[model samples]
Target: MNAAAIDTSTPRLRDFPYRLRDNVRFGDLDPNQHVNNAVYATYFETGRVTLMKDPQYGLMLPGFAWIMVRLDMHFRAELRWPGQIELGLGVARFGRTSVTCDQVVFSEGRCIASAQAVMVLIDEETRKPAPLTAELISALQPWLRRGVKGTRPDLA
Candidate 1:
């Protein structure tokens, strides 16, 4: 599909605050000469890493770890190699111990795929769900998408 045919006026694309640029490498493609379905998960991981590792927006805490609990992805279009991709990320919802992240992959100004992943905060030593700290919640507030319900108060 031609990049020019993509629609970029979606609210999700406009609302996402975190973005990362990546390249489609030769290794990312499969026998079909397009990026493999499995590779989309890796791209989402890269976006997660980029957002969670940012000094100002980072979620990493000492003695804490994040565990992915769920992922839902939609492959909108096939991705080709030798091109650049833009990854957009946002927090869809937050819970006491987990957060749902929404992400989209775009190439040539067109969205190729989108995904939602749930990640839980855990105590590294105990391997148990951990409450989100005030500091962590504050940091994430800026990335929250409006109108998205968040936090199971009972869990909090």
Candidate 2:
């Protein structure tokens, strides 16, 4: 099979997860006409924030906040100038005190980059790790990917 044929059948990563679409402005490109590396990080942030703000998901409990504990990213392809991009994200693991999420940035139906993050739940006053609330979990239940493995480690 030719490269074009291979690409056509490979599932577009955007189709599998919740995605947000954005257009790349000229300002988002560099002198070389490729998207600035920093902008890809912003795309990941956009995906996470969108998920959190949705009424069906997010830090639902009063006085609860999800703080980033760590982030990891891998770049697979360069995104060139002048194209629409889609950012995809989904919960990888949800724990009592923390959750891990995966996000991908796509251009022209191809995944250009991917990022993974670990976010911990914090108590507003104590500023320390806290158990995941049932209400909060229920809110995120609809977004969880089926057949995902392993339980979240105790983060407190």
Candidate 3:
């Protein structure tokens, strides 16, 4: 589903459980003198990757890989290159074989961009979607978006 289908109100960096900080380099600027639209995607990707790939998170399993199927980004304000950006992410929904994430970019306490991404767990051997395990679901519960219903009671 697209981000438009999700309700993320009053973008706050603290709302998301997963967060990281990075500088907005001069190279990220486009002719407009503001950060390029494309750069926001990379920033969002960084947040997701950092959370998923870390061994401590237990989001990864051998022989399985996560692949993004969709990403919808909303640009809210201008981002200048001379500052730093705080990225935030939280698991917003769960499917039998997929997970949806809500992500945001903030600078100086203001939301600069927001994104929702859907990722499928792929069984590397067959290159097909893999069902999420109970353990994986348990690990994800803590990363759920604040103030949003992210999972079904019956869902594993």
Candidate 4:
């Protein structure tokens, strides 16, 4: 889904189930003295990867890998270095073989960007799309977007 379709103009970090705190490194700044757009992708990746790869999450399945197929990012504000940032993510939708995630970056309570990413589960050996298993879906239920049916009700 597109950012406009989701109406994420003024997203709240609290809406995301998985969140991360990070620093805006000086090296991330562009010639314009603001964090580069490419760096924002890395910020989003950090959140997704942490949630997927962390042993506690149980989202990563053996013999299968998650590969990002699409990412749509909306730049909302300029993020400057010497500051702190918070990245947020929630699963928005699930297909037979892919999951769509809604992500946001906040700095000093301001949303720097909103993004929608689609990641497909792939068989490690054949490198082809693989169907999501029931166990994997159950594990991801806790990480869904606020309005999604399976989202953790305790999150607010």
> Against the true structure, whose lDDT is highest?
3
34-74 per-residue lDDT for model 2 (tens digits): 88888887888888877886665555567878788877777
CA-RMSD of model 4? 4.5
lDDT of 4 by residue, 1-156 (tens): 564554645888888999999999999999999999999899999999999999898888899999999999999989898999999999998888888999999999999999999999999999999888888888998888887775222212
The per-prediction CA RMSD against the true structure, in angstroms, equals: 6.4, 6.7, 2.7, 4.5
User: In terms of TM-score, how similar is model 2 to the real structure?
Assistant: 0.80
Name the candidate, 1 or 4, with the larger lDDT value. Answer: 4
Model 1 weakest 10-residue run by lDDT: 3-12
lDDT of each: 0.83, 0.74, 0.90, 0.89
In lDDT terms, how accurate is model 2? 0.74
lDDT of 2 at 22: 88
Estimate, for each residue in 18-70, the C-alpha lDDT of model 1 and write its tens digit. Answer: 88899999999999999999999999999998788777766789899889999
Clashes of each: 0, 1, 0, 0
